[model samples]
Target: MPTTAVDPYLDGNFAPVRKEITTDNLQVVGQLPPDLAGMFVRNGPNPQWPPIGKYHWFDGDGMLHGVQISDGKASYRNRYVQTRGWKIEHEAGKAIWSGFLEAPQMDNPHGAYKNTGNTALIWHAGQILALNEGGVPHAIKLPELGTIGEYTYNGKLVSAFTAHPKVDPVTGEMMFFGYSFMPPYLQYSIVSAAGELLQTVPIDIPQPVMMHDFAITENYTIFMDLPLTLSAERAHRGEPLLMFESDRPSRFGIVPRLGNNNNIRWFESSPCYVFHTLNAYEAGDEVVLIASRMSSTSVLVSEDNQLDPDANIPRLHQWRFNLKTGTVREQQLDDVAAEFPRVNENFLGQKTRYGYVGKLANNPLPLFDGVIKYDLSSGTSQTHQFGEGRYGGEAVFAPRPGATNEDDGWLITFVYDEGSGTSELVVVNAQDITSEPVARVIIPQRVPYGFHGTWVSEEQLTINY
Candidate 1:
């Protein structure tokens, strides 16, 4: 890592790497699974130049890192998302827009502000979108991973797109909603499996909240209207414009699959914040929502906010909303702190027993030292630690081509070995996570730590444009 001034996110494994390379026939350890064929792409913050002011991990430029596997051979490549903001900065040869922690400048020929597109990357409508909740998505060309330009659902996307969108495995319909800092605070949209924007509806909300992610079931789409919010008046007072409010109550708005905004039923719960959900499903007349919840989001007050560094952090929390009696039940599922929850796509929006999440370290920084596999049936879990001085990104499960069992797959992730200052693509057997990895494809450079990712199967690759 390069020596620099104090920057929380720019140091350690979170440091930025400025090079992009492509190489085939990567070196591998152990035997690679023959059934695992496709690409695993992850997005993270990688700034081209030093930030002008305070930097938030989410404000850095977007970069896509991928490893392709065919038969037993693996290949690797990475590139910037080529967003409008990044291109402008690249041309100027220096930093322009201020980071998430501050306001942006008024002089910009590029229409959009810093849509760095640095967040979750997912496959939808036969296209891959590099996303950031602050703005719309940038579509990246498939296979080669080149930026094609901004995707607007064919100009139907009137507002920003969410970094997290739920794709139904049954209908092949992708359900997404976007929240903004201004009027029409929230809106929901649906995209067809064939890459067409079918419908969009304006949603009514009392105020703008940080809706990072949401959940979907067989019939309902759940949206979180938590307390943390952004305000222009508060910014002038020197307080963080976007912050968590202690007096506000958390609300969950449950709406029908194809219903309009007026049909929403808002259910209140204890004030909390959720960055990601494990999964959601339907059981009788109740909707089950499982996510990683934080009791108070005060830690987001500032980039250096560590209100309770020694205290227990966010954990697996469960909530059951009944459609019959208008009542809500909530409880803690586990004591272990975890985030970036993922479930097998084979069982998305349906009842299943397993879930995968990254286990947080003891340090004040948000780093995952291990991955935990949760068995919802027995209330038990198995963890795979990357040993000391090693950290990993989210664990995404890749299903076997024609497997019957839900857990019959492999858990894929990028592990950064801080000691060696290098990274590797590790594949762990989903059925037995505690055992050694099935294979480890060595990546020549370090993969900076970031947020959520997805697994794109080879069959999906053939259908994309």
Candidate 2:
């Protein structure tokens, strides 16, 4: 590995490489958890209560579900599970109340566009709302222009407002990084959880760019920079922003969370083909930014205006950066094309950091995937294979509070089986990554691909809100 002021890029393979993993070999330990194990799939009665507390996925079919896992299986429910309609004001000094209307059913609506990928639904003020693609309201409410109302129940008029907000879990504040289709620029704003504007920080970074994802800590907002060409080409043909790469130096920048919009620190490097995931977790006194970077062929542009991308996409880089120390390290993994990195910790016996990396296969479909355990101190990793042509998403590790570290906790993954042409939401024992998945629940329908998700704690489950 080459070492430099920044981290060195190296050549040798850092870990073992394999071609495929088999799911049949994986052992199924126990029955799925009670909430998920049941045969009866239920939805609504109470319109006031929020849907299932766990992570809910929008399949773009007007079909949304809150997924829960226990004993190795997952169960899902619709967004209308607990929806009550809104009240509309009328002329005769009266109001008209409507009932909960069933959410629209579509055929994989979101997959046509990547906007509804991981981290799509946000839990705010006791309600989990799915933001519509762009500012068009989907599962949530939309207010009319100039009028401010306390609630947005029906499609009727309410307070005019901006939509699809990302709220801070710790502070309970709604936020957004503004996106536009015309000029293709990125903007930022902060709002109240109720969709009221508190601040709009217009930090005009550059043009013709789109924000695939953004990360926020208590102190700052981090945005990954990418080329506008990907979206531009598709726009001409009336399509969603698709794949296009640029040779320009890729950059990552940060600014104070509530400070002036102009305050930003920019750092450039080889283009990150994809910022697969961005997470901020508190490590002692510092907030660390861990990003998984994939190489892009867009970095070989000439001053003479060449159109073709460079020969090959470079190796993947896992980066760690400190906002306070201004330090960044890029670690290169040998043979392993790391993607879908999920961070979690086991606090029972020893407080240790753990991450699961989805390793890609060499096959044409690239369906072969493996799970890796990343040790923070040693900076080394290990892998557990599930099988050939089987792709896994961010693994969710659920441990009972105070359970000993030696006792492997429950690990959940959304596995895609190519042969079945469907996906299974499975759970396993975290301690034994190679062990057979304990509970495997075959989803009734095929789910489209998506991004980040979180497990809602049991204490938060209820429909009263």
Candidate 3:
């Protein structure tokens, strides 16, 4: 069989949905809560051309889908982020550069390595930015989703930005770091509430690792230098990347927010990897980090996804890094096979009682069949399964306007019905996870399974952009 046809990521729900669409009034199944006025936006890859070689899930142009909710009504729109790579390919009418699974098309005159801004979408400091860790973020004005072009923090960002950035809910400051395959392997940066690039500090690491996400306390920032390092040898051989190094120590770098780079304390953990973090905060003498941990990043099942009960699957885990003793303690939070953990945006960087995750299984297709609401206090949980043949994305918690309690809001996600080939914006009441949706804004077209998403309130979106 040909290589392109054999790639699973491009064939199922991961397949690109190329149509750019806008619908003013979307169909709704139930009443859209009056106070639930915000936008649920998600980012995912949608390639413009067939790959010059085999394509990875992350190696494609970005497209953002947004469902705007206001006054019991909903609307939908999607636009591709016009990154440098997208524009170059647009003019060429074909794929010029071979992607992750193939050698780079070095002869192309554009000299463009794919900065497919398709990883995450974050709205902060009044700006909504489409992000891919490979390059600087592309700022787009929404409700329009039009690309306003690359944002370099006034040219302060010299390295690639991570897809996962933490916006300090209390201070309104954004904390982020970038890792590269080249020298100055890791860099930490902070953006002010006013959207100014305040600082960029280069932190030394032994090697370049796929540090997908990090954590923060009031006084310090955390870094994960796991073992899944990018392989130059594999790239030279045109093989799949992110080669795991078993002999390499899985280390975490802890740095004070504004302290000296020389003060970074590195702690060693058992070899493992974290794709996303649930939340983190300071607790007494320790900084607690909650994230989904897997024994390995490698897939354990066959292409047909035969279930392996013995397969080492990802489960929610908690890691406590003692600030005083420099000791690290770890424990698993849940046994469910899950990924894509989230917390209420307002509770970010603080101790919270609730966290949510999407459940996964060994399957040929990427399917998150249900969402779990975990109670951090009692170790209890409630689940909301999108019935059989139905799937959902990472659900974001939207706090009710002027609400007091942390869970007093709604959980929103994009649900795609496999049988019908259509998607819907399902709004689950956060307080009652197992309850029926308060509203279902139906999307006629399939919103392909993607990565991260967020809930942005209307208050922040006062102006277009």
Candidate 4:
């Protein structure tokens, strides 16, 4: 008898939690910040049933783990984003659709692929949207984490929405783009502060690629045309659906916030991929972009993908695009391996001095044993280790009320202890990243490793809900 090989993504902390738990008065290791009044919600994949075929980490269904704090008290809750596929699988009692690792199942009753809303979250126009770039946004209610059904902006959003959208802190507007596998591959849209879908413009690209995220500045939006090409012909030929072409040059398109394809300018850079961006801003004639840059990646496929295993680790990098001179200058800001970079939401789309990122571990799988705070101005960084055998995901900055300093806030994330088989929400002072946690709210259940998250303040919740 032969033993079955275990998929690393489905084992240990990467595994899913079956229970949907809601508990109040969570035990806190230290005093919860009296001023930290908000909910920290992180979104990631949690498949409802065993997958139909070879499963990728990105194929799992969407689940949300949220910790709410008010008046020095804390509560915790978790729920699955009830998508159409989830509901169908719930009724069918098993997975019907295949994942990204397998070829398309055109004969299935449901679509070929499941729209796992497991990527990221955004709060805009009084609604919390659980986003997956493959499909439309699902509106989720806070506190309880209930799905409010799919939000289409009154039939205006006929295409897939980007998981990463930019909400201008000053303009009170949201800017996002959607990519498709078909022609007319890219579209950009903006929503009013009041939540109305204002405009949608088509942007031209040579081919469809898996563009996970982009960047924004106060005056412009930046799109990366990387070499991660998506091909339907290759799928039909029974090959990997995605391929990383190192021979192809990476293109960065700069478009005015309200401009169309004709007004966009393109800049070329060495072939690379950027999964997440820290921030971007305008400085005189240059547009600055800070992000985690990778020389190549094996995220979707490995065999014949032409990826450098050692070069796959993303590092803090910066690129300066000169609009006046049409020349681009790029540099590696830090040598440390990290990803899931975030800045203070209030300072997004503008020049900021500080950033928060998850420091990657030495393990074969994707894991963060610590968090790093980078001082971009001085090129110095501080790390907050989660102790031994502990790991965490993205760290979101929660700005203190009435605080003016850029680092005057809290960095909140879910930390899972492999030694104890338990998880807890850790809160640290943004000013002192190396210090002990301000508080740790021990979760009643374990939280699986996931992707991006956001901090929704009490003021925003009060106005929205």
Candidate 5:
């Protein structure tokens, strides 16, 4: 008899928690900030049943873990996004669909693939949306964290939505784009401050690629056309459906706000991959983009379908696309490997001095041992270590009410202590990242390591639904 191999992603903190419980007055290790009020919610994969095939980290049902704080008291709750697929699987009592790593199951009763809304979360248009790039967004109610239903902007959103949408702080408009495996490979859309879907424009691309995230500036939106491309023909030829051609050049498409494909300008760079961007801004004659860059990645599938034994690590990098000269200048900003970069939302489309990112560990699986705060203007950074045997996910910035300075806020994230087998929400002062946490709200249950999160202030929740 042969032993089954253990999937690293399905073990340890990456594993899912089954119980859905709500507890108030969570014990605190330190004093909570008086002004810090609202909820910190993060979305990630949590499979409801045993997977039908080989399981990947990205293949799981969407579950949200939220910690709400108000008046120096905190509460914790978690719930599944309850997408159509989740409901169907619940009725079936088993896994009906496979994951992205496997070929599409054309004859599945429910559908070819499941739209597991297990990637990221966004709060816009007076509702919280749990987003999976391959499907439409699902609205989730706050305080209770219950799924309302699929949100289509009154049937205005007819295409898949990006997990990452840029909400312009000054203009109060949300800018996002969607990519597809078919013709009209990409589409860009915008929503007014009041939550109405304004317009959707088709952008031309050579092939269908897995574009996980993009960047936005004050005057323009930048889309990455990397070489990680998808091809049905390749699948028919018994090769990987997605392949990274290192010989090809990575292209950046810069388009003016509400501009069409005709007005888009393409800038080329060496072959690379960027999963997340810190920020982008317009400076003089150039559009500046700051993100974590890698020479190549085995995120989806490698060039030949087999996983690359030596995966590339991403590092802090910068790219300046010169609009006037039609040229690009790129450089590595730091030597340390990091990802899940974030900045103050208020300064998202403007020049920012400080940014936060998770420091990657050398383990074979994905893990963040600490958070690094970078001062871009001074070319310096500070790290907030999670201590020995402690790991954390992406740290989100919680801006103080009426904060005048960019870094005048707190960085909040769920930190899991491996030694104790417990989890706590650690709040560090954004202005002083090297200092100890201002507060630590101990969670009643274990929080598995997950993807992106956001900080919704108490004022934002006051709006009537």
Candidate 6:
């Protein structure tokens, strides 16, 4: 029998798209200007749209706080003002850059959201500050520009090991998590709105562990273990590392709210698999999580995903879990490599729904990629085909707060169209998950592939407007 090879970037290999051009880009502020010339200017083939309300921004720093996004025709106000950072000056003008390539300073330059519920929640070198309702920054550190508090961390370089402070729903205090060692154990902290240290909580998870997504609900903080382990050098230098190991199964675990630090509830497939994305959404009394699991021998790091011609092919699966009761349901997709699964509640029914992207087995051809709309109750699904030359980013559900049914909400996503040489932001009505888009705004420029983004309402930002 002959095996067909698969290419991970099959859809990414498009004709080319027109990019957003900017005349007033930032100047190289470090020692070696030439090498840093285009660090922030280069974009990827796709960008993610995180599931968030209208009060956050994916700031330039790694922090997800008061960042704003809209179609090209809109310009809004925000509380926190974000900019790139600087490294220590070295002799001979050879600036010491941190992380990958040892480039001077870190340049995330873009994030999804900045929560305004608490200000000091985003205090860190590579993090963006959360904003207030009046569009005023509360934690960012610019003396003349919204500098309202000070935050202190144990690590010399903070962004390398920490997530931006997350506000505690019950206490209004900010929370932060840090990891160390090989597989990477966990450390936790609770901070005040003025950036004062409240308390530090530590945990014994494992080393070399990388957390892609986590969630905080009414009862607990959920963290999932991933194979993407970073070397101590990579962790310290802030370099990005890829995981391709086959010895372990990616596990999903949860931490009770300061209840049991040493206890972790993990779930995985026996045949072995990797969970690519983690998402949580709360409905009545239950918290729902959706993840995409892959079973390839190893993750294809380089773009050329040519499998060894004789290697056996693995399947991808999607799983849903009820965090409170510890119940789970797993569903196997027909022969396709499922990558990203995004879940959100649109209808007020007893079940939930999700949006995922993968190839169709019926085609068996390389180019037909599409999105699936799945219902948790009926156990039925619908495929929204994007055909060829199109790629899908993360899907986000934007529902008016307190809305019971998903029918009144909206589903927003990014679709890269190679033929047009552009990535478009598409908004589809949530009621009819498969309906035509209500609004389609072509991003002025082509944004490369990115991790995630957030949507904030105009009223929550502290805009200078």
Q: Which candidate number has the best TM-score?
A: 4
Q: How high is the CA lDDT of each candidate model?
A: 0.87, 0.45, 0.84, 0.92, 0.91, 0.41
Ranking by lDDT: 4, 5, 1, 3, 2, 6
The best-first sequence of candidates by TM-score reads 4, 5, 1, 3, 2, 6
Per-residue CA lDDT of model 1 for 246-358, tens digit only, reads: 57889998899897788999899987888888899988988999999988765545553636442237899999999898899999999998988999987888988999999
What digit string (tens of lDDT, one per residue) describes model 3 on residues 1-465? 655346777775677887888897889998999988878889998888988756777777898999999999999998899998889889989987776655556676877377889989888888989999888999988788899999998877888899999998889899988998788889999999888988888898877778889988777788999887876677678654556666677788888877547899888998887889898889999888899997766541122232334334679999999979989999998888888899988878899999999987446455788899999989989999888888888888899999889999988899888788888999999898898898899985778888888887999888545
* Global Cα RMSD, each model: 2.2, 13.9, 2.8, 1.0, 1.4, 12.4
CA deviation > 4 Å runs, candidate 3: 1-6, 233-241, 299-312
- In candidate 5, what residue range of length 10 has the lowest lDDT sum? 302-311
Candidate 5 lDDT (Cα, whole model)? 0.91
For residues 281-308, could you state the per-residue lDDT of candidate 6 as single tens digits? 4665445554455443333232224344
TM-score of each: 0.96, 0.61, 0.94, 0.98, 0.98, 0.56
lDDT of 5 by residue, 401-439 (tens): 999999999999999999999999999999889988999
lDDT of 2 by residue, 251-341 (tens): 6677777765468876565655554443554455444555455554322221123344422222334455565676665666444666665
lDDT of 4 at 393: 93
Worst 10 residues of 6 by lDDT: 33-42
Please list the residue runs of candidate 1 whose C-alpha ends up more than 4 Å from where it truly belongs after superposition: 1-4, 106-112, 303-312
* True-structure lDDT of candidate 4: 0.92
User: Model 4 clash pairs?
Assistant: none
Candidate 4, residue 163: the lDDT equals 97
